[model samples]
Target: MKLDEAKQKFVHSWGVLGSNWGINKTMAQIHALLLVSEEPLSTEDVMEYLKISRGNANMNLRGLMDWGIVSKEIKIGERKDFFKADKDIWEVARRITEERSKREVEPIIKILKEVKNVEDDSDKAKEFVETIENLESFTSKLDGIVKKFVKSDEHWFYKNMVKLIK
Candidate 1:
């Protein structure tokens, strides 16, 4: 297939993947575009390529920046602001994992810790407390694993993963 067709397919696939990961489709599409780009792209360039409105492009670009995957670039002698995605896939994965762990896992762990304390002496209350404790334990472990993965080097992680799968 042509390069343009391949890029389009990749962008669409990434958008779908982002949606599955609880991110906006357009935001992922923008990231895909920037990822494949040889140089940074301006907001107008992104809007033109994606056929999106200026506001949409700007908003998604900002969202990508907020996620710490995309960054703003200032080109010399250029009036428009340009955007670029972090080209290192490993760093991208680590950042996303760290952010999700903080946003999702940390909150669940905190809530579980708070709710696991049940003062009632009844059987149902005991069961409830036990269940909460189990959940808290599991989530805490998961959070720990995620934290380790985020901090580990790519080679070490892949080697350990290979060993586990073997």
Candidate 2:
């Protein structure tokens, strides 16, 4: 494929993956644009590139910044701010992982852990409580392992995960 085609394919695939990972399509497209662009992009650039509204651009930019995946750059003599992606793959993946864990997993796990502590063991409740406790313990351990694992270098994280899987 030609360079332009390749880039288009990448942006499309990345946008789809981003959707599955809890980000909207235009936001992912904007990020993909920044990822492949040779230079930082201004808010207007992103809005034009993705054909999104200014409000949409601003909101997604803030969301990206919150996840530490994008940052604003100040250029000399330019009143407008430009945005750039986290070019490092590991950092990008790690930040996404951390954000997803905090946004999606933490609350469900907290509720499960709390359920495990409920004191209503009368035969049916006994089984319910026992099962919940087991699941809570298992998920808690897994969450801890994820926390520890994400802190490691990508190579180390993969090595440890491979060994644990084996």
Q: Please report, in order, the local distance difference test score of every candidate based on alpha carbons.
A: 0.94, 0.85
Identify the runs in model 2 with alpha carbons over 4 angstroms from their true place: 162-166
In angstroms, the error of model 1 at 71 is 0.8
Model 1 lDDT at residue 8: 93
**Model 1 compared with the native: what TM-score?**
0.97
Candidate 2 Cα RMSD (Å): 1.8
Q: What is candidate 2's local distance difference test score?
A: 0.85
Candidate 1 per-residue lDDT, tens place, 46-129, comes to 999899999999999998898899999999999999999999999999999999998999999999999978889999999999
Q: Give the clashing residue pairs of candidate 2, or none.
A: none
Candidate 2 positional error at 130, Å: 1.8
Q: Against the hidden true structure, what lDDT does model 1 obtain?
A: 0.94
